[model samples]
Target: MRLAHAHSVQQSGAYVRKFGAAALLLALCSSVGVIATSGTPATAAGDATSASRARTDELTLRTGQTLAKVKASIPSGSYAGAYVDPSSGTLRVLVTQQAKAPALDTRADAPLELVKARYSLAYLEQRMGEVFAAREKLNGKNSRIVSVDVDEAANSLQVAVDGPIDAALRGRITRLAPDTPLELVQGNSFAPQRYAGSRVDDFAPWSAGVFIYNKTTGGGCSSGPGVHVGSTKYMVTAAHCATATGQQFYQGHQDVPSVTPELVGTVANRSGYPNLDAMLVNGNTANTVYRSWYNFYTASSAPWESLTGQTVCTGGAYSGERCGLVIGQTNVCSDSLRSCGLTIATGPVNTVAAGEGDSGGPVYITAPGLRYSGIVTGPVNPANSITCLNYPSGLRSCSNAIVFTRIQNILAYFGASLN
Candidate 1:
């Protein structure tokens, strides 16, 4: 309905906020953690611990460090939290801080069981590399995963995972390697685009256009204010926008057919094909031609390592204009598109943040004019759920986060440099 701040009381609740009784039911279901249980003694024994225990186990950290040593070292201020990965059978130790400390406690009465298990140095090294690689592949870029050595002597793990590695994975790694030195690599081929500004109603000095393609009816469907990448025109819309077989591009301000509509480019390389529902549109000359009329700014080539708290803006046919702060970025892989994620924000934007016809509008950071940020791909509405096959009967699920095609990746795909 209306595009409002994510923190607003109306919007700031859990996923079930809009569902009412259904939400309460879902919460109950989650708390119970059991769907069906057989009436057998073994089943009853299994039920001794609720299914939520299993879920909690999944998130819990078990360490492999000896109990005596862990207990003896507990008061050293070096220990934090510990857990074990059931899937990998590795112990993970979360360090609270980095400081000099005595050796781990190896007393027989130490509470090692309570501390959870930890992985061997070698295992952690390999696992860190695997995480690094996974993030790189997902981000469609490269990065390094620095290994941390956990020593009983120091009571800390010196970890390093950072740089211009990949946007999708950066946040995760940062969370996993908290307080560690993460060097973000920059100046690489894949960099994130900054938000410019949006097109207000009948706004002057800002070129406004729509992204369109032919539908089955011999007519056309359109979405607009395609973002400009460089001298070449490009629009960021949903992959579904150009999914029609005979798709064509249209450039205009409103839904009305242009008096002399020019043919812009159609979607070429689309990510989040199935799940994310995003696409990249290569504009025709008509697209770039319209940009001249408005004081449109070109995309930036600079790589944005992170956007938390950074002021941003968006310009679209629907949500005329809005501004806010970058909250976070996440990597989301759906059946349609893999290795894709989006950067999210909360702010005072247009009334209707986005609508059906606003799929390809640009999301930018505006100072006075506009610095190209990203293209609006999808809405983060709670009503929209991702169709994922997690249930036995095949079901879809919903999440609070929205998805977008990273602008930096789009510009690189077209071989266009952001200003």
Candidate 2:
């Protein structure tokens, strides 16, 4: 429910029918590998080398050029180090230092090394500044602060607190350290939930790669990587996904297989799209069966309460199958727009992180194998910014939380049952 990070690209709303063959092929060809943390084994021999190596590879020189000048041709961060091969008229870039050196075959058409060096150096400096600023603000906090841990990969800070604090305290902490990934962990014992993978087959009836063709926009689309609900055959996704309005979902790397969605009879009656951005696809047939185990519900009713220390998770196209803790909720109503409630959940935000493609994805909480939560309606207003100050209230809107839609209302509107 938290607005962790905004999508840099604007929403096009352009729905295309063709499946992304290129993306699907890339996923199929690439090996499925877990991210190797700093201490983990290098998955491949080149892995370690690539990690430490400078990116600059080949640089060419006509005449009368010093090694530093040639090195400047490559980007600053391209390689950890470099050397000039005077005989070959090439500048060799060393990427990593391993027991065995990597092969650097320079060809005539190699690019200028300086370009890479300059860009990488600038990028590294910018990121370091952000990290340093976040740390300084956290150090000045006066509350009963518990512990502060830095997520190096995410470049954010996770702060644990003793108990619930007022909205004022939350705002101050966020304002003091705007760039840091500030997460408020409740009791000393409770740690935020980390992402554990899910099985595609367990959510039966709705196969992970099943695609639905949208007549509205004439496009084929699939559900993003999340639990799909309904009679095993039928699945649910954002109405945008079902409608294919520039919103397409992905499972791993492959696009969900497309089928002419059964629209009129059982399909039309059961399939639900509450508004312009929501949709449900029915896959129930004679042979296909729905699995109750896959579905879930929300904890609160419509117009939810922003209770501090409350925990929640959302299973959707972007956040994929991850869960996090909720830090803020707000009721937004206006003349043109009705009261659209928003809840913010936070953790490590990713790319398919949550975008137009993730609409209609389920946002639910699970206690191991027990009760499952429900689907998210939409993201919070002031849409994409991770941290924003509410002008009138002077409170920070989810500086530490992500926003989400209330699920119970959506479920009730569709007349669907959840366990």
Candidate 3:
């Protein structure tokens, strides 16, 4: 069956080898930017709208580029995070020393604000690692440390947990790192799970965040990219969502027994935390895999890329589309999934929070170019989650904290590219 799946990917279309659909689609979209593409829904961007989008796109790119310059211009361990403020359309860099921070300006003339932070990114990373290690020290000492994240916006390292951190744990954190600020939460902030919904016979028109069911068991997850290893194809999803390699996946929504879905792919687990989350769907390569942030029928989409402070969006079958800003990046650890494979730390982007069922969905940006940069690996539990786009009051909206595993890493792992 694996051999057959490989054959199907190689045979998805001969045209791809000669004139890949991806290349053709890029050309078509480029000639007239997708934000400006015709036949789009009425709400789609118009010519003027496209022009404005172009300007914002350029601004977002400039913000990131400028932030990079500022970041590099300063010595290491000087700043915590850089962000493009959506409201003010400004570039803000978190600095450990007010005077030592670089004084730079973006071409967009975006405002630059250097705010003092208690710790630099380098220090935070170093200490966060210690904090993670500290979790073991506090095993039964009464702290509910589910995961730890660097909250640059707040200039502190925020810890997510199933419950509160007692005085002893807080004291331990302070003693471990006197320079760092700390905050505690009492629940799984990023909960990725199957939401209740009816069945869909087939994902006729393929989309990145379409429904994917566990064929033998009874549940579903959203489909990720149609990734390939050499010619062997696979799909993407959260590791917590997939139990093992060859675990059957289908295009159905109903639970098992009530639904025996046609096999689309089996599990091909990627490098993901066994207990926490992340995974891949290996097969169904012959089928079209749409990597859109919105549309399911679009023939081509952007490749996976990454930039720290750019704006982006997320899409899941459960929650259609949610757009937000890029906060930064962090690595999360869990007491669950308790092994090397399960406990291994995952580098995840802190941005564009999505709700339940959005796990394994794509995190992307539209400016400079529309592309899928990473996969949603957060909102691991159903607690106070934010609805996609329904910000301020939705599930997993705290800090609008959606985490992602970079696509570049995923592609590199498989030694393959998108079809």
Candidate 4:
């Protein structure tokens, strides 16, 4: 997508490409205005709502820790899924049956509410596989299916589509997993939104979340956390940033007048489209990643595993630091049905969780310091957004929701660990 001027800011651009019914991941490059380079920025404080959210984040983390322990103590087959109640700010654990729940050992300070579920997470996951097997029958020439994911709260598999599904196709999907609860949702579609343009002066000992321009395409995107494959360090980015291996990426934006930017790295490997959207760049990388504008030390040894209803943040090159984004769906597929295993997060209405030029940026949590969560992939229902957040100066479609690939999946794919 080309950047157009809007709201006195240059809208960042995500190089648009189409694949079937969905937009393929785009090359990124966005020129952002001057940003803070020093001091601790506000974590969206100074208001009642922000203050409430801060408390909720702390509670969510604490409850999440408890939930982890609870799951570890129980049989996998007995558990369904878990989520933090959005309204009450309480942890809710789902079990196949109330009788399957283990003896509670809470300190009275933090209590986990167990809810009986109709199906286990494993059951829903198995059904998801079966549904994917019948993608061709469900997604046809006019492809209406946007995404398929397990809705933990609903204890069912949700199939998101842009329009109505005929009775025959519904029956076909139902037959794939008759016992599994299937939910058909309308008016939902996702598109790839890798960004183009850039940042300046991203020096050596490179950190993630800084801008890097593709020398071949002249498009740029924010970087992800650094990782190590054996003894060598490499940078992580969205695979859509470069079409092939060996392409060089430069530090800073491409539109920096007549100046040539510094070299960041070369694409060593890439996994895209139908698989996890990530790429490895052989470079001098550090364990630090950008939170807002400044770099923060990442807990490389403890990369975060995403959970439904968990809060998240992103530091896009163009969108800067945005937080209070809640995970809405996990292990989801895009509208194309090829891009699968992505996580989706939604921000406040009309707010930007991430925008073009944000792809490949770090999606992390920041309660007890920054922890890597995933890499920004794109926007959900990209065609229609409540509002667009300007990038320096331009018009671009931005949704309150974002799509990302988990960090564990990326590391596993590259046979690397967090740096």
The lDDT values for all models are 0.36, 0.32, 0.47, 0.63
Worst 10 residues of 2 by lDDT: 17-26
Order of quality (lDDT) = 4, 3, 1, 2
Q: Write the residue-wise lDDT of candidate 3 on 189-295 in tens digits.
A: 22222223222343432346666656544334566666666767666666545434677877645433454456776776534343223456766542232333223
* Model 4: per-residue Cα lDDT at residue 321: 75
Residue 77 displacement (Å), model 2? 60
Ranked by TM-score from best down, the candidates are 4, 3, 1, 2
Q: Which stretches of candidate 4 lie over 4 Å from their true place?
A: 1-14, 18-199, 258-260, 271-273, 335-337, 386-392
TM-score of each: 0.40, 0.34, 0.43, 0.55
In terms of lDDT, which candidate is stronger, 2 or 4?
A: 4
Alpha carbon lDDT at 86, candidate 1: 40
State, as a TM-score between 0 and 1, how close model 3 is to the true structure: 0.43
lDDT of 4 by residue, 275-300 (tens): 45678988998776655454444333
**In model 3, which runs have C-alpha deviations exceeding 4 angstroms?**
1-206, 255-260, 275-277, 286-302, 330-352, 380-383, 386-400
Q: In terms of lDDT, which candidate is stronger, 2 or 3? A: 3
Give the CA lDDT, 0 to 100, for residue 242 in model 3.
45
Candidate 1 lDDT by residue in tens digits, 253-275: 22333233455555554433423
Better of 1 and 4 by lDDT: 4
Better of 1 and 3 by lDDT: 3
Per lDDT, the best of the predicted structures is: 4
